[model samples]
Target chain A: MSLQDILTTGTAPKRVAAGMGFWKSLFSALDTPVAAPSSVPADDPLAGYGPQAVEITPAIAANQRLILSTRRDIDLQELEALCDAVGWSRRPVRKVRRALDNSFLVVSLWEQLAQQRRLIGFARATSDHAFNATIWDVVINPSFQGQGLGRVLMEYVIAQLQQAEIPNITLFADPHVVDFYRRLGFVLDPEGIKGMFWYPS
Target chain B: MSLQDILTTGTAPKRVAAGMGFWKSLFSALDTPVAAPSSVPADDPLAGYGPQAVEITPAIAANQRLILSTRRDIDLQELEALCDAVGWSRRPVRKVRRALDNSFLVVSLWEQLAQQRRLIGFARATSDHAFNATIWDVVINPSFQGQGLGRVLMEYVIAQLQQAEIPNITLFADPHVVDFYRRLGFVLDPEGIKGMFWYPS
Candidate 1:
């Protein structure tokens, strides 16, 4: 069920079968041990996301909603499609796979259509548990962007970092979106405390 | 024999027996797949590290020579001693062990003293073989700090990252050492492109 459906119906998500051990280590390494919330508030902003709702055959409507997950069960095809959709400088699939598996926290969004969960929005973070955390690859399918899902996805990331008690959340944004992040309460690094980075050939 | 001794003798240091499989994955995950350097330039900067030399009894001189290694065989005692010597925030030994084992690249330095090698310097890095890499914990024992060991250690790291063809090398520097990095060719993030980060609590 979609996170919204569960929030609305006061039910829990169907837990996916995976070793909780990996999650435990990931959270521990990131400095915040977490248990997914038992239930979110009824009026949660997240619960309001049937935004682009369309009346379809009842059978299809039941399955075609945005599902949000905090797991690493990404499918290769779906991941590549998302990468292509965002034009992420083509990389070998294995390279992307290793990067995904190594991330400290990953929030994946899927939209069910034709009984298949097609990846839609994806964001991953790397953290040192106690000190530094960075947000990377915050992308939503262009078709889904303005429906408020981008904000929905980013808000989920910020909230998770906050809950983890991670004090530092850093991301480099394309110049066009500086204000978008400013609205989320991030400011430029302190004056003279600029960023420096080198890139590979 | 120490790295310096190998340099002096113009012979390859004996490769340690360990899981090549793990190093294979670590390097693949960090960036490019690499083979050990085929040769060293006769005028290599690493060779000049022995420039500060003193004549003493063979017994006394043996205790002061610099040693370097790119292996993961460091024991808990040496790691702990190095951490204590640097006055780092104390952490459980297991936590430090986990971090060390997870590093993408680690360059460690020791001083051959009597029959034991005392940890004197270390730097580790994390990277996505494609885009960004960060240098962290570039530390040297205070006793060895002023004699250019830190420079030797960091130069080794830079050369490795350069060989990996990693595009972006980033590090957060202490205010006092900004010029040290500045001399190494890093510049402030371009204007309007400042860095933003949150600290872990």
Candidate 2:
């Protein structure tokens, strides 16, 4: 087909926010904690997608009750403040905006007040949706840290990746907190695949 | 705010196909090769958003002239056939559909005929649009390989990621192809930060 004919014919690849008809329902399902159907005889919401899914704990159940979303239409200044609150390295506001907007998955946590919700935790990941993914910039507001909100946020990220069947998840952790991620299933690099990277000279 | 209140008050994070607005123009621009803006002060098409971008390369110039897109409304059967052609690991049609639907970026190539566009090359990446992204499933119909089509396709992916200001891009390459990616400016990972991963047994 000629360029003109090809462009005019067949469905042009529309960017699916994946909110299209069926995927829309699935995306909505990700928004809420759904009960397993009695007819199915299984209570695990993620059973069909993959074998590995987190067993919901009391802490998770309570934390899940809080507002969690993959929403990108968030306040940047509010995000900037949340970054500051968590003692994160400084990132320019614009850089952070592009990052969040383009993130493959962003798990957002909020504290719902009488009339407004304040940002409380955030974790974002870059993934291929099939095989490999790397997570970065995980944070939970200091006041909310020990309350299992971080676990809820990370578990949500893990479940999302797991559901997509992406098995290779890699992250670089500081020496002090290696055990935190170890408990969540991350391990040291297997001997053969040395992690090599280059930065601006 | 209550869950109901937050859901109702703040935007429920409508899936920004992101292709709907400015990105649509860029997506369309990617479909058609644009002359570098010389007389115009802003030579960079992606300038307002980020600092780095690729000069639409010669290979890209040729490929763009062919017809390129991120359209997700694709035929799964056709994809299955393409996967068969490339000898990729078998993925069920449903899984292929879901993966394509969720990829952060997808670049498709077509050979324009009088009436139809035949899929000739394909590349995709999963990115957070900021810090990290991984490219995957880079395959070209064997008949279309070795024409620098792969380079053209990858350069497009790199440019898109660079524009998002995502600094860290990693991909697992076979030893033989390491130089190919290195020529395109990827380097060995830095020693201290090893790449580590885990999978469910």
Candidate 3:
């Protein structure tokens, strides 16, 4: 297929299904080339769209449970609210949704009340899954700042990547937070690895 | 599932399959949820494996067509050899393979000869597929370095991402190539976006 066809129609060429096929193929490739299950079992949770959330339980506050989830089907409204609480510029919900879907890994943090759960922080990473991963959109709700939820979020994300055997983990920080990342053992442009970006004209 | 289960078993909870399911779910989430087709139709290119490559036809040299493919099933040996040609440290083939499988986008460049295609240059990006993308492992074979194939590869990768509507693109480069990326409109920490990384202790 022509490059134009890819851009215009968004018809990914053969084997290029970005979501389900992509993830399954990756796992299969990681372990071995497994045959596609002739059919997903009727009771399999994975039979549905997104995988189930894996909640990370860590004590964050008294009388409240702090939890983190790898849920990709995050509620867009809750995420937007978290971003708003941090005073970040508003991004279109549609685009935000697309970003989450495209992300290799997404970690969402929440404060669980007696009856409800609130999204208090969010982070994501995209990776080549071999050499490097770059994280983006790390934010904690203003009310939850200074409680160390941000640190907890980052640590969990980093641990997960490391466990998966990903070698390098990176994130772009604002001037104010450069020291914060450093305290977490993140060195800036370590060994002279300079960061670069490209913006649309 | 408990975080321990996630770490130990690697059985991603509900929707966490990193390969096919992850990708399909993301796409469905991006557009709108669609019913999983009951069964794969025979002859569907996507039904079996990775997507086909899309060729960009711009002349790099006469007779020897410089081709870029989005095809993810790249030969790890060729990639390792290209890295060797450029004097990069050796990486395990398995890890390199996983990295490509996990990447959001992978661009492999080839020099088409009368007899066969030779792997010449390579680059990949990991993206949230919405807000940001980070380019990685950008390299050109020493034999092909001066002809500007590296620039062509970066431009095409950036353009595809921009067309997909992602807002930010990033990469970490050695000091030597920082200026090369700048000429392509990438700035160093534009507006104070400092890049940071964490390595295993």
Report every candidate's CA lDDT: 0.55, 0.55, 0.65
lDDT of 3 by residue, A41-71 (tens): 7642223222323233334455565556677
What TM value does chain A in model 2 reach? 0.65
Tell me the tens digit of each residue's lDDT in model 2 across B35-98. 4445335632232211222222222223332445556666777766777898887876766776
Question: Which whole-number lDDT from 0 to 100 does residue B98 have in model 1?
Answer: 61
> Residue B18's C-alpha lDDT in candidate 3?
19
What ranking emerges by DockQ with the best candidate at the front?
3, 1, 2
Tens digits of per-residue lDDT, candidate 1, B2-68, equal: 3223333434322221121111001111232333344536633233223111111112143354555
Query: Which is the winner by TM-score between candidate 1 and candidate 3?
Result: 3
- In terms of TM-score, the best-performing candidate is 3
Question: lDDT of candidate 1?
Answer: 0.55
Worst 10 residues of 1 chain A by lDDT: A21-30
Q: What is candidate 1's lDDT per residue for A10-127, written digit by digit as tens?
A: 3332222112211100111112232334454663323322221111111213446555566676776787789789787776777677777777677887776644557788888766
Model 2 residue A114 lDDT score: 37
Off by over 4 Å in 3: A1-62, B1-62
Where does the lowest 10-residue lDDT sum fall in candidate 3 chain A? A21-30
TM-score for predicted model 1 compared with the true structure: 0.62
TM-score of 2: 0.54
